[model samples]
Structure formats: C-alpha cells, structure tokens
Target: MQFSKSLMLLATLATGTFAHPAVGRRQATATSAAVSSDWTATPSSGAYSTAGFGSSTSSSGTGVTYEGNVGNPYGSNIIQISSSDASQYKYVAQFTGANTDSWTVAIFNKYGSDGKMDGWYGQACLTFTLAAGETKYVAFDDDSQGGWAAASGSTIPTDSNGGYASTWGEFDFGSTTNNGWSGFDVSAIAAQNADMTVSGMEICDALGGTCSSISPDAATVNNAYTSAETDVGGIGGNIASGPVRLAVTIDYSG
Candidate 1:
C-alpha cells in the first residue's frame, strides 16, 4: 500500500525540510535519506522467546546480567528476533546502559538498502558507549549499504532541558562483532519503507568474545514488544514537529 502525500509532507516537516542533494531518484541514498522509521505496539500473543543469560544480579552486584562476558559485571543476557514478517519492516532495538560496559548492536539483513545484501549504500550500523549512568539516544541507521555511512544534518532530539535521553542499544562487542544495534524508532521506519527479511536480532556481552545467531525464542524470557499497526509506510511524525520516543522491544517468529 502507498502512503499519503499529506503524511509524507508531515514527515518532511518534522525533519526540518526535505531539500536533499540532487544526486539520485526518489530513493534512500546517502545524501537523500529519510529520518529513522517508527512503529506501533504489537499484540501480546505474538511475542517471541529469548535465552543466553540469567536475570539475577552479576558477580559485582550491579543488578545487571552478563551473557558470556560480553562485558556485563552482572551475569549475561540477550534478546532475539526471528519472525517471518520481521522483514516486512525496518526495526530498531533501544537500550539504556547503567555501568561502564561498552554497548553495541549487530545486524544481518536479507535485502540491502537498494535490495542487495552486500551492496554499498551507506551507514548500516551504529554503536554508542555511555559514561557511567549517562542517558543518551543512540539510533542505528541500516539503510546505508556501502559499509558505514554517516548521518549528516540529522539530530537526536534531547529533552526539553537539553539533557540526553537515557536510552542505548547493543553492548560492547565492537563493530567487528556483526551485531549492530538499531533504535526502536528506526525499526518503525524500516517496517514501512522496505521489504527487509530479518533472521537474527540479539543483545549480548561484547567483551566476552562473539556470539552466534540463536533462536529468537529462548528460555528465561521476560517481556517482549511488537507492533500490530500494519501498512506502515513513509517517514513518521507527519502531524507533529518532533518525534515521539517509543522505548520498547519484542520477539518475532516466522
């Protein structure tokens, strides 16, 4: 289904202006890319499962868990996504770190930005390391296929008082870990713009070593988040000046 022009205009307005550089057609290019996508909440029954770590406090009594020394003083844990429709939209996983553990995200897309997995587009993944108890907004832009593209003229909205939003994603495994992170808002956009089929989504300790693609449904599961709002297309915030933050995640099953 196609999105309305009014909505497109609204999305453009929310991101300042759509005056992109004249270098390509109507598509997602490094110079003319839309803001990160957004999504709605999914129903309760379709949530997936997770595994890899325990919920108990870590050895340092930091109340965090460690999953195989990915760098958590607590124990270890991870969240997975392997849904069929997961490819139907773009997705971003949002997180907030508590201690000095490096955080990062990994991604594997079936279809690259222009539709090829190994094609060159733009920045496909992003990582953010937080200071002890620092709150910030970290978004993962996967539309770029040409290695790591930079997000120019884009800004992460801070709180009214200019304080960073206390949210982060993925943990320290470094960029080579193949598990880049995406924010919840960006996922909402991907779900609408492209036909991306996702096979793996995970969050683990980056320092311990590396992790493999486990099932989205694992043991010791907690709460999960998904979106039921289908037919999501085009940029979000079409009716407002600023984008609304949705701090939620969910497991998907094929």
Candidate 2:
C-alpha cells in the first residue's frame, strides 16, 4: 500500500490535526494474533494517528489510515527539550540510541490545543530527524495526559509532507496531579494492523534496566504490543512520578 498527501496553506491551521475519540472515551485493547502485512481496522478497532500537522488521511484499508504528522516541525536534526530534566521529561538516550541512519520521529501528545483527546494527538508538537546515537527528550506537564513518539524510515514509508508512519513508542506521564505516575509501552499495532512495515524498537529505564520491545529477530515479541494485543491492557511500565530517563534503541534486533 502507498501513502500520499494534501497539505494546507497555513501550517498552524492543522497543527497536526488529530480527530476521533476524546480522552475520557479513550481505551486501549488488542489481540495476540500472528502479525501480517495486511492489517486493517474499523473506526472502533486498531489504533490510528492524526490527519493534521503536515499530514492528511486517505481512509484506506477498512476505515482510516494509520498515519502520522506529515512534516517535521522542528526542522531536521533539531531535537526537542534541551535540559534533559529527569523530573519533567525522559531521555531517549543510550541503550543503542544511535541508528545506522536518520529516522523521522514525531511526537503526538495525549491531548490537543483544547486539552481534549485530539484523536491520536493532533499537533506534531515535536517533530525532528533523529540521527544514530543522538539524544532527545519530550516533556510532560501536570495534565492527566500522555502520548506516543513514532519513528519511521529505513523500511517504512514517508509521505509527501515528510512524515513517516509505523513503529511507535507510547507513553503517559504525571497522571493524577496529586499522585502522578508515568507509564510506557512499545507498539506495532498501527503498522502491523495497516499491513505496513513493523520496525524493531525497544525502551528501557535510565540504566537499560527493565525493558519492553518489539524484536524483529526473535519470533516472540518481548513485553510489547502487537496487532493481536490491541485490546490487551496492562502491557507496559508503571512507575511512580519522579526522575525518569528512558534509554531507547531504535531499529533494535535484540
């Protein structure tokens, strides 16, 4: 399957427009079916991405296309979050952080400008080109929200807007202002369900301890989410709020 685009004149108008399902109605679930390249989903099934920012939707497969923000908002090679504050953010550093080549990574926060479930996150708030071994961070506010950072390239497809689809590292931080918690999980649901490429990815704590990942080599995925496990909950990390620095390895094989 191929993906294309129809960009708007005013970039901010779309702000990576994500539609469908608000936060209160947002629920995660899945199956453990064998993965294939012909994955599809109805409106109420499988997870999909936003149609705003620099990307648009084509209503492919059964219903909607599992897309990403079309363009890189932070330009190329410009990482987001400079301080690397462990308290308000997590780092995608170390644990084989560098890739053989650059991958376009897009961040879709759990909420939109209006603070709702902006679908799969409307704005590509932090979009950039990530080089091999490069370090970057995404911040979390006091709101009861979380989101995902999707990286696509190598074997995946990039739309005309320069957005890459497939391969996602989902996260949520500072949930419950008084007693917040941070959680994370790796997922191949959107891509595998859309019959697109499912690149390997892994996420670990600051010291490369306790991990979750989608191993392309191993026949069995290690503590990660696949199309079959869409409805399956409690499949990720749940840590109390504090300093959290995650070590990420993109295109992981182990």
Candidate 3:
C-alpha cells in the first residue's frame, strides 16, 4: 500500500483550495497521532510464509494463507488481549491479491456478562474491491470502537464505539460473488498498552454453521504481537453451505 500517496489523496479530498480551520485542525490531530506511532508486525499462528508483504510471522506459531478458490469462508483471530487491566491496541488486516474481485470482511467482537465468551457482537463490516496486484490495509483500534482506515500510520476515524473488550476479535473473509480467489495476506495485532506483560497469543478457528456454535482454538500465541499468514476458509474449495457466523468469546476480569 502507498501510505504517502493515500495520505495525499485523503488531504486533497478533505480540503480544497479553501481550508477550513476546524476541519483541517481535527484532521491534523488525527494524522499526527497515527504518524507518531511505529507499528510492529504480530507473529503468525501457524507456519510463516514470505510470499506476501507488509507483515512477518514467527517460527513457533503457524500461519495460514487464504488464496485461490473463491466464495470460500475464511476467518482469523486478529486480536486477543488477556490482561487484568485496561489495555489499548490496534489490529491490522491486509488483503493483497492479483484479481478484480470484491470481498467482504466482517469484524466480530466477543461480548457478554463480565466479558464472558458467551455471545458475539458484530462490531464493523467492510467490503471493497481490489485491483490486480493491489494491496490494501485496514486498521481498527480497540479503544476507539469501530474506527478503520486504509493507510498505515493513519488515525482511525471515530464514528462508533469500538472500544477494546477483554476478549478476542476476529476478521471473517469471503467473496461477494463466486468469482474465486480473494487473498488475505496478513493478520497482525499491535499492543500499545504500557507496562503490560505479554502473556500469550494463538491462532483460533471458528467452525460450525451458526453464530452461537462458533468456537476458537484453546492455544495462545507465545509472542507479544505478531502477524500470521493463515488460510482460514472452507474446505475442498467450497464455501460453507450455511450461515458461517464469525464470533468470539470475551472473558474480562474485574
């Protein structure tokens, strides 16, 4: 993704020849915050692959690469924070492909009584088309609710309450049509919480045909923050026959 180019475009779109101080000032604040932070790639849950760019995986965990065969359902555990105190973090989901297919990504946040992993909340949903060999990055902050952006180092726009919960978050990828082969190259998470000990991380899979039945892997990621290149979709090049709900369980502590 062309971070500088996209920022220029965003500026041009936000303001014309005449600049509004109020709007410009707000934009400037957001831009500055995003630019100030350095992003670290999260480790992969499975085996690591260098076929894609933007993120890397570690040796201990495995990575899944979702490519080829359209209309299949794929999901990944994007962020999993298990801290006693409130923590702030950001998740980056990068999609890279060489096709002109439209894809839909649904973000699910685990919620319930005391952040128990009892229910799942649909936080944000996004759909976009990718040109051949195009790489696009979407980011969301746990503290800011459902803010998302296309450029890396770009501040998340605060529109909805996407605040972080004491649970797991996931990204579900699928095609809008049966066109075939949408790519999800990277699944990365970055924690900005200060003085927080890195406990564990792992790749999880949500299976079944309904939202309530979806489950996650019991393992945790061994590293602090890392990226994964895992293939999270249906088997035999076919999409799941029924409603494949992507949900997570939250277990918050007091």
TM-score winner among the candidates? 2
Best by lDDT: 2
User: Residue 161 in candidate 1 has what lDDT?
Assistant: 33
Give a tens-digit lDDT track for model 1, residues 7-82.
Answer: 2111122222112222211112221122222222222332212122223211111101111111121212222322
TM-score of 3: 0.22
Worst 10 residues of 2 by lDDT: 3-12
lDDT of 3 by residue, 142-244 (tens): 1111212221111222212333221123322222122211111111221112111221122222232222111112123321122221222221112221212
1-254 per-residue lDDT for model 2 (tens digits): 12111110111121232333222232132222322221111123332212112211111111112222122231111124433222222222332445577776666543334433342433555556667776555433322233344454523353333333476777644333213345567777666645557777888865336678887632458777777766555575655544345666777766
Global lDDT of model 2: 0.44
Q: How far is 239's C-alpha from truth in model 3 (Å)?
A: 30
C-alpha TM-scores of all predictions: 0.23, 0.57, 0.22
Residue 160, candidate 1: Cα error in Å is 45
